[model samples]
Target: MTLSPVPDRALAELGRTEGGPDTLALLVRDQDTRRLLMLRAVLDAAEGADARVCSADARARVREDWALLAEADRVAPAGGGAAADRGSAFPGDLAADPASASARDTARDTAAGPTANPAATAPPGGPTPDPAAIAAAAGRAPDQATTSAGYIPPHPPLSPARARLLHPLVGPWARRCLRELGAAAGPPTAEGTRELAHDLAHFSALAAVAAARAGISYAVRLPARDGALVLPSLGVLRTAVPGGVPVDVVHRRGRLTLRQSGVADITVRLESGTGAWSAAPAWTPAYALPGLLSGAGPMPLDDLDPYRTARGGPRHHALSGPTTLDDAGRKRWLHSWSAAAAALGLGGEQRVGEAVALLRCLVPLADPPGSAGGGRGGGSCSGTRREAFGAVLSSTPPTPATFAATLVHELQHTKLAALSDMLTLHHAGPQERYFAPWRPDPRPYDGLLQGAYSHLALADFFQRCALTATRPAHRESAWTLHARYQEQVGAVLPTLVGSGDLTARGRRFVDQMVAVHERLEEHPPPRGQAARARAYVAAARALWAGRRIRPTG
Candidate 1:
């Protein structure tokens, strides 16, 4: 049997708790819109918590949602079959158990219920959909776009919200391309316009699915009482959606956009219900529903620690590593970074330090248990809070410098993941060590594109340490080992060249590295060292330059 889905609604609310994921309770009830809003808030909080795993705030939110969910009533489903959307990474493996099943039953019941007379269903309390009810929906799945046939839509019609989710760089273009959608959304007297709006909605749904898979946030930017809205996640908002205005969209320049009408337009709509409406009549201000994105960064090794955290984050397990916490113990462990002579053949005072450093260096950046093929992801941000981080490594020897460096490594990935633009991904992935193309498919990262440049960088760093240090070091085998890594670098050169994500400078660097490789056997630096360090450094420089990017397709 598959493990539970950790329902979207639950994920949404739990993601909001201030303390971290630990507080989230699967049974909590949540209004859909509130959950979406919470999604924004929590993502921000997660980002805010940076490099920290689940925060107390997040856990609190999760607990709250779970409580609400627990209070809700359950119902039976009309169709007993589980809803089929796209095939999941593991089909049904992600569906939640028990409570979610109950919740889905409730949702199906609600959808099948008589459309409550608008007058009868309006609760005196507020406009928010009942949280308990929405939470119940966790068991059911969202409607599918098409059947499980091999049929793919000719054009990926973005979801009604998809166009609005494009990153800032691509937003303007969405407006230009979808500008006509504004006029199309109103009550269409013409059969042609009516059909178009219907079609647009369907397309919007599709776009929404695609955007979701890419992990783009889709919340509309709402106004704040204080003139500034605080968001916990990366997303877009409708700066101008009036209460009654139906959403309109524009998908252009790789972004899907939504806009709102001005107060004047809303007033006119309220006043002129009797009169026929047109674009020219009391037109509303364009809704600038904006969106942004955030990424969790490299997958932590502890993420594989299934039982480590109460929140859906990596947990602290004894297996992760050693835990000596005292200062004396720390001092005793800080010496391994030195050469064989410095370590005095493994028993050196610094050997422990070096091993700790190596673990710090390698494990911090290393691939998560099963994630090796995908290249190293954000291992650095596994802990949602400093306290959480402290707890995970409570037993391990502390190394602040290495810890901080690990943070930097994860941040780069988080920044890339947050861009919300496929094109930028196409650009960034190649330049990063894994050489994964910035495109949607992950296939290119394998083969040789996987580890070349970073290996070059690693070699360069280690080589520099070996050459520059005053301590005695191995002279002969270092070059031999360094030369071998260069061969691995050469194997992936073609993948890098085609990455499409790389800038001209990145391409030039790869080319230069190849050139340097051809002459490496000939250019030994001197009696004490070799040309390996200088050559790899040159190669890495070429890969580093580029303009920030946005999505293209």
Candidate 2:
């Protein structure tokens, strides 16, 4: 009990690192646009040297490169439909909508842009428009469009609702990431800043391509210092942009802003020293759904819409219709767990947040205490995979202590789902489901392990709650819960060890879980409490056994 809390080994692995190999891709949308924001390293050797070049030379080379590309391909004009087909966003830009595209469609076919579609490049009728002819038609001097640094282009106004949704999806990450990129820029700094800006511009163009597919214009407004360099880079990037949406890059006075059609602007500004971050983005159903893709966060009860998107897989249990807890139940559950989260500190509670955000959807299952307090596991359904995660909960947890422990337990299952995505921990084993203390039906090895792993965390949470508890009753409850979970989880561990379902990696992962649990087991409650805990676990196991053993007669 005296040992200070150790960071959950699993969470340390799951935490985000700047530009890690993991997919940081997110689906962003507004009333008129839906685009996938993806992380790509575009600061390759071609642009790397530019960082070392003089500012004037860096600026010139960027402009020249942009001009060539601009000449080769024409930018698509804005305004398209909101709901786009799913496949249009990924792997590459959506093919230009042949229906409404102007004469430029012919030019797109002949253009030399790397991402230009040769299949659709030819314009209708006359040969593809030459750059000079196209330039003349648009009434510009033959040289090309401006790549002027610090130029702020006019943009369509953003809706307040769209702004709220889009900001959370990209703003925070953008500021932090761009700041990091700026800091990494070497001294003389001019060259590096320009290169960094150029990369940002490229990303912005890609964002625009996605927005275009959703039938909207896109623009990324950056801070003054960073935007100065990035603005010039946009000229070059504009040409390279795959033909699709019309996207512009601009640097404004303050935060980083992403402006798309019908959505309010998303602005991200990370201040120095203070560590003050922008207000967390407000949540909306459309905006919130993507969070489920990551499977973590506090999803609003009303936001759970099953029929919204086809991307996600089904949950084993169906989502109940409009599950809104009464105000009393809401206040009680929220207050209890919020306190528990503070007690658990960031490390203990982070897994819960991750689970909420990733699952992004909650179905209120509300089981009474004796029967089952609901279940924890990644999925409950079959068919097309969903970019969502689901968790079922009892209408009211029997006690605050029970509520807190359940939070940790379910999050552990959610965290495991995320880990499963990152690492292949087990091989398929015999489908013969075995008895698990927590579940009514038999479970395969994976289910058994999930239960064991989650309860290990639950046990740890209760154990800590017991130690830090201020009141005698709370202390007693904590110890009792702690013992019960530890006993149940420990019993299941032996089964998991022998299940023979583990791959090499799965074995190692389970070993770590066992190691942590054994360490906690080293500290036991008073003999009376220990006995009660044992009985509690035994009762649950007995319940399951009786149900399973009952004759089919």
Candidate 3:
């Protein structure tokens, strides 16, 4: 599918390791659009699947639901505001010809349009779906036709926000699922094909439920996984019955009722005018981050999505599983986040606001031992995924300052991941590893570049902290960290420039990074602190060399 190009100005600002909310918002909107196209592709592939690849029943169900979703989009109201707030326009013809000239040109045009405000004019992509439909549809019951097996819910449209949320639930899985189904060596074996089709059908059911929740009154035959019906970004509904039971999800007005054959119906109330939910006895709501940053919405503390795994490799380090926190544990996390926001504000209020704006979800990880109470080793360890844009999987840091620094550090990774999606900063080549001062093991070129970019932000964060810290000890600590990261970044910049792995755009990007580093170097740390930083860098290099294995001819 065609993607919007990253304007040179936005690229440069990001290269300097800082793209306030506006630039990051553009990257997010583009990612959202790309995901919409990807989902459309998945549906198209499912529609064309033969009996050998996908069963007729599964294919039929997919086509039905997909058509219903498209109809919902087509009938959505106009003047619904910016796509970022509501969601991108449904790619009605994206699956047919994603790379058409019109699609390519629209990408560029949307970038130039207004996106800074939620109330800004609607983006070009037909009409935007009204998210407020959730409130408007709150008390209405589905007509007989709506509850029938092969009928579409007429009138009420799916909220753009609810529609956008479904992409994260199925987009990444679709990428891999499509690849396996479309393998050049024919599709997988019968058993494998069945599994893929089954998964697609299940995802379709989930999508149906999401669309239904946006005030459309309908009943969906949802399959339960391990006796539970999982709804991404919302909550899970557990039932006593096991196996593939035909559970119907009925939405009337704002109340969602889950009805299973032999089991009692479960119901929950959705807040009016917003996607937020009220507590339900039978459902376990997903954790949400406390809204600590001013003017920023609460981000989901996602621990339930199956596809929340870290992309690339374990070197990025992310925690996995359906991790749920107890009351005390949840309280600790909330407090830490609040303190982290305050600490980050000291460094730069605007930067903190921008980081908060870019963050969509937070995946919690176990904190390291002996790192509590602001210890050195207890700093946050966080990672982001290429497919899961806007989600950060992170461990809680002991101190607010450490947590604040981690936020800045991960923001760089998040920005770079989004930026890389739009532009190719480096060329693909055989694996070449290089020493990254911040990491214990040697890193591949891309990993090294990611490290260098993030560290540049860390250096800037620490420099600001050093200048703004009120206490002398805080000042000293910030200065030490600033000098150390500055040295580490200084060592990596030359390697990146000389690596011969960068594209012209990549070289330009690195040049901007170098410019930022040079300006930071102009204001050197104290003599004693600089010596300590240099010694630390030398020690790290020595350790790496000691562990290096030289290749033999």
Candidate 4:
């Protein structure tokens, strides 16, 4: 692969423009309090022009907004608990516990200085918080509170043992998610960075409402040009913070503070402060993306940042794409797929449902704490099935399209499993193994897995494209697998799609789909089998595009 040949400075600047994600590598070693205070002061200076809050009345309004946010959180379904429910470290039952800081709690309910997000630092016109900004906030975690970016997350990353103990707090299924997420965030590889960033961002978005629920105030800490930590003022000091509030976050002495962002902007006294951003006071409420809600596909990937809130991206490509699927929708994908597993006959059923089930089974492998596949026929022939099948899918949502795609992907796993079963099925005696199950082998995610995934992804995309190119809402049954005919192939998936560092499989998947999209767009949609035949041709060509994604499978 050829380098872009962009100059170093230009590249650095471009990287910064991409939100300076590498800023995470800069660790603040000095724990000195005074330096921290000065840093906080600097952050206060850079506060965006719109960030502002100076009056008690305005603070009160912010409080009301927080209350409404809390109510919304209560009503929001905690994702089918598929994700690990990492509870807030802020103490669930704080009233009776002596750990409760009287001043903190009082500060939580009523403070009259500024809103958690000041007008000066508010997004242009007070739109949702940017995902990049939220990510920078993750490393800016406050000094005393377990919360970050305005929310007391329900859980932190947990190990298997730790996850088990916290299951009651976050629930078993969520525990699995939490443990896996934690590992993903801190994994030893580059993809690990992706997972880590994604998790932090995801929770941070949720934290916006979570902070409101817990009545916690938050301030984002940013690094100054001089290398000091600056806490962006959400508007506490400029306004007269009311007293006797339960949670208080004061940024006066430096260091980002965590208090209820309601009425009083409370600040926690960190022994140190970074820099201070602008000091105005005003913040904005966040909501779902307009495009996604309306059912449009493909918004700029960056547009989803505000919705993400913290750092990183989604679990996989589809999830990470310019599309947004709610937690409930994600969980349903798992549930529906599980139900369809037995119906696929342990091979590609050429249906969306099969793909969905296959993906569900594969997702569990992304984590260690989650049990291995047992519910589906491909996993095993155990007498007692999965300890709790709902343990995984329960947290995911069930979307028809997503379910179909996931089922298709997972069926491949079943194929892998059945092949493994076949190895053992033909054993000459109890001592010999016939077929080698693909389960125990190392994953080829970066290799052949990438190739195969690319092929199928395009195959599916072409199927969709066939309808899309033809714009065929009118023809219901014209839908058919294109892999059956290869003569009219347009291009192979491997050569078509190109990414910076994709594995062979990844490259192929993107390649095949790209070719299909290009082909359908190039050739005007023909009527009947001709149109379907063209799509089939396009898919078959791409199906053979990528090289050995599964290696042997």
The top-ranked prediction according to lDDT is 3
**Per-residue lDDT for 406 in model 3?**
72
Name the lDDT value of residue 337 in candidate 2: 34
Q: Is candidate 2 or candidate 3 better by lDDT?
A: 3
Native-to-model Cα distance after best TM-score fit, residue 405 in candidate 1, in Å: 11
RMSD of 2: 22.6
lDDT of 2: 0.39
Candidate 2 regions with alpha-carbon error over 4 angstroms: 1-89, 95-299, 308-340, 346-387, 390-403, 430-432, 547-553
Off by over 4 Å in 3: 20-22, 71-88, 91-158, 161-170, 184-187, 194-198, 242-244, 272-281, 310-322, 368-380, 428-430, 550-553
On lDDT, the stronger of 3 and 4 is 3
Among residues 3 or more apart in sequence or in different chains, the pairs in candidate 3 whose N, CA or C atoms overlap within 3 Å are 138-253, 138-254, 139-253
Residue-level lDDT tens digits of model 4 in 183-254: 232424555433433323222223232333223444321111121111211111222233322233333322
Q: What is the C-alpha lDDT of each candidate?
A: 0.27, 0.39, 0.61, 0.27
State every prediction's TM-score relative to the real structure.
0.26, 0.45, 0.79, 0.26
Candidate 3, after superposition: displacement of residue 303 in Å? 1.7
**Candidate 4 versus the native: TM-score?**
0.26
Point out where model 4 deviates above 4 Å: 1-209, 213-288, 294-447, 467-553
Give the per-residue lDDT of model 2 (tens digit) for 210-231. Answer: 2222222223332222122122
